[model samples]
Target: MKKSTLALISLLIVLCLLFVWAQNKILNYRTWFRVEEKILMISDRPEITKIAAMGFDGLVADLLWIRGIQYFGGNFSTLDKPEKRSGMMNLLRNLVGLDPHFLAAYQFGGFIINESIKDHEQAIDFLLDGADNNPLTEYPSAWRLPFDAGFIAFYQLKDHDVAKELFLQSIYGKKFAAVSVENAEGVKDDDSPEWLIDGDPFSSTRFDTSDGVFSLNLHDERQVGRVTVQQDSKRPKSYQLSYAADASMAAWQTLESVTNPGFYFHDFEPALKAHAFRFDQFKIQAEEDEEFSIAEVKIFGPRNPATPSYVERMAYEMDRAAGRFKAALDQYMRYYDEAVKKGDQVSADLSLQKLFDIYTNKCIEILQETAELYLQEKGSLPTAQMFELIQEGYLSRIIQQKITEEPGFVEDVAPVLMPTGNVWEILTTWDQKDPHLLITYTNDLGEEDWYITSRTRLIAEQKGVAEKLQQFVNKYKEEKGTLPENLSDLLNEPWFGATRIYEDPMGGEFFINRETGQVEARNPKY
Candidate 1:
């Protein structure tokens, strides 16, 4: 063989060896990436890492995302212990840093770490970062990232003002977005109710300024958006809505006037310092035989419903963090109700779910506390008085109205208590065992302009089942000198004025645990 040919073959062999060595090195680094601590150490400087990726930024981000999912999914069983998921958040942040448009990383990672690991601050940071980095052009009509951040601010952080601000940013681009009509608080005047209508049909006083005046009594200075009037008579007449900065002032400026009036809808720019408003006049009045009646009057404006003052936001957060549940409950419930009344379902639902969570979690907490006290004081499980104590001590009046009695209050702010066996039972049984159950319930009816606000309906039938079961359990203990052997024992002969107990709403058998004296809905179809 020629010497030149032999040298060429040797060079080729050397090149092949070098290629194999480089491949092995790459594989080693890939393996190291799977190790969370190593990922954390390497990902400490994301910009530097991105630079090192040699312009394959998206590819690098994808690889990191895969690793993050593996880490999250593999060890999710240990989610309760956040320490076990130490490097999960770092992995996600690094993933997003490489490719800011990797929205899935922001969404899943932000929610997972925040909800499961209880690192809400980091989760909120991820979401806010995504909101800032990914604009509407790239992620068109995508408001979720900012929305997620807003949720964390309101629900977890309990900062209402921050939540409101973030929510507005999500809906409207941060700069362009002012609080729109959907979010603005409803302006209601206490005296405005009495002034809405006056006098008998024959007297012709409904539209007469001397007899009665329709007005809005704003609690504070707010921006007025629109006013709607439904006249009882089909006859066309000119109607003018007037506004005044002060309720006491006689000077009135006409906000809107409609000549063709069947269902009058007048949209106008809000007064910057407007306070009180009233009906100016009704033109072309009907004869004494024809009575002018106004059926409904709806005034909409920018009342700033969910935007709490700094003091209120701080108080709520402090109370929630310190575990002052009743105070926290009151604050949350009021916010939820107010938001609903103002037609801000987004804020209302968010706050409503938080209220339920607080209520359920707090109830379980107090149950445990009361149970512990009973165990210490009387020993064993509690009796009738113990149940009574649970009702009175822990649970508040839970104000619910079947029929709304308050005048000028059109919306019903009742709790939308969905039928579940006993919420407390669900909490105790499935505290963190099932994460999906913790998801907030939405308005199944529809999304917009709900006459009855989207609230969890507390069904009477299901409530009876829970309460009856509790009574039966205590009764069994009293009569038999121990807990009943089975639920059938309590079902025997007119115990609840019937042979069998009430069926579970989910078409399951009502289950009673003899050991714990707790009731549950078991054997659900799905």
Candidate 2:
């Protein structure tokens, strides 16, 4: 063999050995790294992290997101530790900070913080930050963040006021207008009820009888909130407020009863939707041949241009969320059947329990809303029978009416309550003015189980009452050419007639803001 050929072969052999050694070293390093647990260390300052990203924030965010998922999964059992939770949150913040449009990361981080870490305030703040970062005009899916925040506030924190605000934010635009009024029961004459809604609070509608009725009609079904009634000298002794969805005036649901009525203003939380409202059972303190009159009847509701599309969007998002859960439930049921066929009892049990959870949650969501309406109307939680009445058809009718009246609702079948064997039990004590519903059901374990649903009714009753009082103050000033020395002076007037002028629902005192001459609550609920 030639010496040159031998030298070339030796060189080739050396090169092959070097390549094999390098490959083995690389494989060993990867194996060692995989075995060792890695810690997720991130900068506390998002701005610093964003600066370091060098316009590759999106790519960095993606990589960090994957690392976050792995870290969360691996340390799932230890997430209860405050340090671990903090680390996870920091990583999430940095990831989102680098890429503000990383909506999935925001949502996932919120869920983990809420469900695993049980840090409600942080979760809310994080989710709201996501909502603020993504404007609804630019990213329509941004609504989900606020909706999720509302869910956390309502369900976890039990802060209905905050939840209501968040829910409103999620829905975006909701503008109210004055609802139209007409004479429904009173004698038809020139002094018709139509004059009550003529924009002039002084334009009077005279009724000859002690008892009279007026109807409020809206162009479209709207979520009616504020209703202000101004009396012309002779106020009714009392009145009943009710609503109906049709012109027939059948199936009217009573909203409220005012025992001592004068000038009244009420703002309903979680406003009720209907086509018409009725001021019935108006009993005036009348002497013989004396007539009472109503100066104005103002009903405020969401009837503006933006309301229709916003409302539709809200309903659609809610239904979409429900649909996702339903799809998951259907899949679980299928898996349960498969598990049963395979005789995998444990898997079947797990699937069945999951199905029950999803079903119960969805039912509670619907029931909670209906129960709230009942509470708003009756001023108390529904009894079993009352709840049954609502479940049977009343709620369905209200929903159907709303859907039918909406401009773009064209579904063949209106959503209705599905029949379930679960029983609703109302639990309350003598001291518990606001009670809750306990739903009893047989779970997958074939045992009696219950889920409790409760919520606080955050109504600004005093706010409305104070505004009405301020109106009275303005009237008193207009009449006497001076403000009353005290609220007591106005109560002494014959038109008011010793009727309790203002009582705060949350145990606050109504006081006059002497500077602005506006009535204010000492401890405002809102």
Candidate 3:
């Protein structure tokens, strides 16, 4: 009887779950159907499953509009027409309007439409529509679509200040309460003289922007010179450490004696503020002692990508958010003015506040959200670029893995710049013969050099070097009576003394084997 009761209870539970699932399925199907209907209203007006078949060229209209894909010429030679790309933008916007949370579509659509329309102003319609749709995730991808579109405004569109402002604004979405506490003064030894917090916090002895580029303060008294700036306080992601020599000059020199990322000290009598260097960059440190004299060590500034100060990056992000908001607001205000003039009072007033509130809330939300993201993504603070890449599906582990795969090669080939368009341009080159000349760009800075395949080709090009060696061997035999066993003996000869058998540029050395000449260099693997 007990078994029977248990079986009956199990059946009831199963039936109940099935009923609930069925109800949920019906509700979801109904909701999706409505959305589907809305989508059809925009594109497939007749709501038919099948459209006229397209052959050879897929969607003739799309072919004409797209940029890279050919539309005409009956062949693949011509670039894709821009008109098809515009149609794609419209299609993507319609797709996004139906389901706003389709994040990849925004990226894909942005890539094509941004280029197709050529009018960046109109191209944003699809992406903005996508940005407004929320699919509901902890990190709402909808928030990111506008950013991808905004790049069109900045880069492809060539409205630089606008692009920059948008990029800066994109880094922010959540708010971060930038918390900071003033440094506590260390207790001095009784034997030492008392000291006061001297000069402008940002003056010669100590330069504290307080926003975390760097803090430089000098302590002085007697012959003992010790300048203690903030050490390990934090480092910006892409900053260089240096100090100014004076106010009038606009240059800063690298602190050579310093070993760590954020501290410096020197043997000068009393480390005072450098009153000379004022600007940011300086030449490499030479052996000159006075040039490296100690005064103050500045942590990298806000502009420095390496700046790790939470307070500073947060502030920079906020300032950028505010700037973008102001501009957007101004545009909104203009629209509002026109609406009011046209007697559309409801829209004029509502639109005005809506724009302001969006910008204001955005400013607050992003500032707060950044601090946490920085700690989560970087463990400390993030650089401007790091902040941008991390939020966009990029993982730090992948970046580290890529960096590690090349061994020290990543550092050796770290590019100063890469090409970008609406998307970005990547040049993939393969060189099996001459590696030295196989560099991506032929013209290079004086410092940049090739180490791998290019080096091997350079070795291959060295010709007369071997011939020169053979000639020397013959001459040695004639002069020294018999061939010398080693090159040292031949060095005494006039020709040997004056002419070299090795190529310095190619790093090739010639050796004689059985009266024959041989040229060799270190292989690429080495």
Candidate 4:
């Protein structure tokens, strides 16, 4: 060969070597990614906190940030400089996203991280992305996102409408996704005894993974794109078609010819709900794409249930509005309950949860009656007392009606201290004539409202604030050998710099009496 031809051949050889080296590096990086995941799992295995902490490093820090964002917006302020802004969220998201099986990334990164930091918008976005990206058993986690979101928004943000809507979406999504609607072991949805998923379409109670046999769930009426199949080697690749019925999940069924590789859905079906399908199994032969690698097949199909039904839509709306309200009630109720119990004297009917229901029920009654009331009178246009009186009225009705409808509904319910399991049983309210109590919250206008509010609002508002306050109370006792005489005295201490105010949701104020170290609500009903 000529000199020119020799040099050209050498150059080709060099290029081929470079390509091989680059490919190996990419493969090795993927292997490390898997290794890092294992490290993370070991780090977080609850039983190994101390051990995990020992091995924890920057990789663990990154994992925590990802987890933290879904936890409480990751409290990046606690993470130091650059890690705070590194789009760690997106990086964390990608890590959890592509795997789809890493449920923790979705729950911890998507929900816990977001909820912890109160990053509502991002939380929703991450969840939605997870919903679309998650394959196979995504429904449970996906449904939880909306359900949990609704709960958080309703309970924490005091936004009931959004909460209501999110719950509805969760319900509908579960149905369309073909998820089972059976009560998840210990879930307590107020309306679940009434709410249910509709649709079914399979007759064979028993099925097998035989190659010629195909199974499909036509839960939705959407065009299919591809499937990721997990198979038993003995059976090998099989071409199959599937469809859903009534937008229910338990209704997956097989339809047509089986194809190799991922499916490319043809003859699009656009009826109702989203569709999920796949081949029977994946075999080693299929992995090599010899005949066609197919393992744990999940075919991408058409979107089903394109629009929310009127009733479903209504439920969603209710959840949205109630979510924030419920969330606030939940947070405050816990804190306040702790404070009440600290004295070893319990507050009756004072749980934040009960207060929320009581207050909302009262609001409903007021709206129905078309009446306006005031702060000092028996009833007010919108005061804590007015809400309580109305709530009491509703309670009486609920009790009386239950006697007529389901007389035994409240029979098994026992009077418990605080944090009762059933929402209805959570609180045992103060007697109507009981003294008012102090509670506080940051109001809509961003001002702290503190007052001697009704037992209902007071109980709910104090739920979370007590933890921060308890530390102060404990410190005062530790330093002075007794409790602080006043809020001002606590403020003079080093740790009490910024927390001068203790406000409840309706804005009740806590006062410390000067004469005794004993801390009593200058008012007691809270």
| Most accurate candidate by lDDT | 2
How do all models score by TM-score? 0.34, 0.32, 0.24, 0.29
What local lDDT score does residue 33 receive in model 1, on the 0 to 100 scale? Answer: 47
Question: In model 2, what is the error at residue 70, expressed in angstroms?
Answer: 1.0
User: Tens digits of per-residue lDDT for model 4 on 1-526?
Assistant: 9999999999999999999999999987654332222223332233343345455444544565555445234343332223332334544544553354455566665554454435666666666566556432334445555665665666667676566546545533432334232212221323221121222111111122333233344444554432323322222245454555444545656656643322122323332244444333322223333322222322333322333223233342352244333333333344345446665233323444354453444333323332222233443333333345336454344444544775323322222112343323322343333323333446769986543434544454465565567677878889889776666677677778875566533334566555644333443433
280-353: candidate 2 lDDT, tens digit per residue: 77666656455556777766543223222333223323322444453344346555776798798877787766
- Candidate of highest TM-score: 1
lDDT of 3 at 442: 23
Instruction: Estimate candidate 1's alpha-carbon lDDT, on a 0 to 1 scale.
Output: 0.55
Candidate 3: tens digits of C-alpha lDDT, residues 1-526: 6999999999999999999999999987654332222212235421221133223223432332332232211212211334333334445544444434556656666655555445466657666655445321233434456456556765566564455434433433211112111221222223110111221222222122222222232221111122333222212112244545554334667644333222222323233345321112212222432111112332211121221223222222332344444334434555566567779787677665555344334322332344345457766533322333335533333334545784432322222111221111111111112221222212236453322223343443555465566677777777767766765556677667654334434443444454443323343221
lDDT of 2 at 239: 77
Candidate 1: pairs in clash: 185-303, 189-217, 416-455, 416-456, 416-457, 417-456, 417-457, 417-458
Where does model 1 exceed 4 Å of error? 1-35, 40-43, 75-89, 177-526
Q: What is candidate 3's local distance difference test score?
A: 0.39
Model 2 lDDT, full chain set = 0.63
In terms of lDDT, the poorest run of 10 residues in model 2 is 408-417
TM-score for candidate 3: 0.24
In model 3, the Cα lDDT at residue 396 comes to: 37
Which model is ahead, 3 or 4, in terms of TM-score?
4
lDDT of 3 at 39: 19
Tell me which of candidates 1 and 3 scores higher on TM-score: 1
**34, model 4: CA deviation in Å?**
31
